[model samples]
Target chain A: MKEHKKLPSAVIKRMPRYYRYLTTLQQMGISRISSRDLGNRMGVTASQVRHDFFSFGASGLQGYGYDVDLLRQEIRDIFGLDDLFSVIIIGAGNLGHALAKYSGFEKNGYKIAAIFDVKPEIIGERINDIEIIHLDKLQEYVQDNHVDIAALTVPEIRVLEVAKLVTDNGIKALWNFSPIELLASDDIVVENIQMIDSLMVLGYNLRTAEAKLNPN
Target chain B: MKEHKKLPSAVIKRMPRYYRYLTTLQQMGISRISSRDLGNRMGVTASQVRHDFFSFGASGLQGYGYDVDLLRQEIRDIFGLDDLFSVIIIGAGNLGHALAKYSGFEKNGYKIAAIFDVKPEIIGERINDIEIIHLDKLQEYVQDNHVDIAALTVPEIRVLEVAKLVTDNGIKALWNFSPIELLASDDIVVENIQMIDSLMVLGYNLRTAEAKLNPN
Candidate 1:
């Protein structure tokens, strides 16, 4: 992989959505798609979709538009999806259990290696054949395995501590599910999955819709 | 609530992040903050922060900058965070159970009224005093209660059917946690929380960083 200028954060955030939609189109046996149709499906303007693809250096044939399979494969390569990314969950709680059993991540190149927890009752258990190990063993496990991502599903209070442990032990990326934001240094990439934030946005949009309907 | 012109979806998406960071500032007893400092904390440029605030019609004092509490409250209001939003989860699976137990959503005005599941084994169980009801009763329950949001944590295969049932009974907004994207008509608002998308972004970012480091 050769180094290129870093893409803007907004553009990086949208790449996965494009990848997902392109894959959907491919699955439907749609071999080609115009930006207009793709934008319609994604709720964005055709120009917006074109601008996004521009960031990826991807273009369409003037008349035929994009080749769905080739476009999806190119985006997949940009995401480094061809490489298997071994992941470990740092909590064995409900969310952790669900993520371990989620087949979607596995399909997208993230393989669940194991789940780690501090709870004695959960330490010896397994979810979807991924064994749960005590938190104390996480550092050693990372040292021995090619762990690429650590899904931090631990509580907020313990996030900084757990994050420090994971990053210190060679895990360079985090899928943080904690309520509090985790501060990452230059070397680490942290994607904060704030569930409450998503719900709040839904609340705001729903209220806005009601205001439009009732005008009160 | 009066209807103003609709804001851009990109600006709407950034509101929760602003709200979360402002709340964190308020909690720390920080009285004032400049756009630059806020940008430093949020990993964006000062100009970007100012642009975002400009969208909200919020301006900082020439020298003193933004009053932390006031800015936070204003953003909170923009998000309609003061209103109580009753929500129901469509699945009583592990993710649904976890969301029902997450107190963060309750703190932000989204209340979990009940969880709906077709599985008899989970139907009677409760998480954080929110009972799981049979899926057959969801429509009736929505009619009787003021349900504003449906947290769709069901499997991807069942999403469309479940979404239709809830929306037909008056669920206008969805906090979807399913892997597949949900298609929403004009009357419905769907916030698709694709967990796998987040992970893939992290993987892409991590690989990009590695490419920068090794240049191979």
Candidate 2:
């Protein structure tokens, strides 16, 4: 119950994937999962699953494995997601709007607290209950709401500039959708999403699987 | 080069990461880089770099290292990105739009051939030269343009449905940004872009670094 205990970001990251898999099992009305079963979801070995789960002090039993609901709660607590994070949206572009009204945000203990955009065309528009504020109002919003994390869906050319604006306003983390890398001070963490690298992997994997099947 | 000559998928996956590191060196005007430098960028041992590079036919001088530009080109060619890939975007949501208009996509030989959306609201919208078309029109576009790969950025609830539509339309590979597990047939491959997992790893590394700095 310690207030400021930090989960290793890597552990925090895997928590979501694990959460996704567990959610699938939960949807199927499954009550228990061996670490191997969890690993099978991501094409990883069961030992790898046990090792990853060990980092969070929850390990599947040798015979009984893990109680799906209990493991999910333990992870939720470790990731500081037991309470919803007040997440603001920066850059009310298509990406920002989709994200602001995204279904997954609420599911993962995140609230789209505010939406910001510099464009006059979209400044006052609302996505769901959240209104789109001008980017000029970012500092005020961040300070007033004590915003801790933001989703940067801005133009790649301005990703760093906007990142500075977000971090300077006392934000500690960001879910960056910008293609370019955002260089941040050690205090603030930024995650870049690369689409092509992902696509290439899928293509290569498919090709590899086909090759394996037809080894002539 | 033979079109169907399949490289190891693991090699293909890591190529971009190594390429990014080399590109960093190129930006710094570092003409040559040692395998150790690549290893450091990847958080792997220098010997591991030597081992992987050997597989790639990087039989360079024992003392010196790889030419950064040359190695970069080789990596690009190995990943089959020396030429542009005809790519498409499925789901005109936040992640999809960000991907369609991403500069990194252009930089990496991925050209957005089309964008598909099921929502009637987005069907006529445009991201760069790519116009969003309804899912009903996807097969036409894929057959006409021969879009080699598709990126799935739909929500979890719609991920499987959209993936099925894309693959059914002849998209042999998919880059899934949705935070859900996809069941791909043997003929198609799906790779989930788990950004949270990567960020978690970064977070864990940061924690380890912090622990080393402030060991109690």
Evaluate every candidate with DockQ and list the scores. 0.76, 0.43
Please list the residue runs of candidate 2 whose C-alpha ends up more than 4 Å from where it truly belongs after superposition.
A1-13, A183-185, A207-216, B1-12, B27-29, B36-52, B59-63, B93-95, B118-126, B195-216
lDDT of 1 by residue, A1-216 (tens): 224467887888888998999888888999999999999999899999889888878898898999999989887777778787999999988999999988887778779999999988887887999999999998788778999999999887899899989988988998899998886678998899988778777777787877778775
What fraction of correct interface contacts does each candidate retain? 0.83, 0.45
The chain B TM-scores of all candidates, as shown, are: 0.95, 0.85
Docking class of 1: medium
Question: Cα RMSD (Å) between model 1 and the true structure?
Answer: 1.6
Q: Pick the candidate with the highest lDDT.
A: 1
Highest DockQ against the true fold, candidate: 1
Candidate 2 global CA lDDT score: 0.71
Please, what is the whole-model Cα lDDT of each candidate in the order they appear?
0.85, 0.71
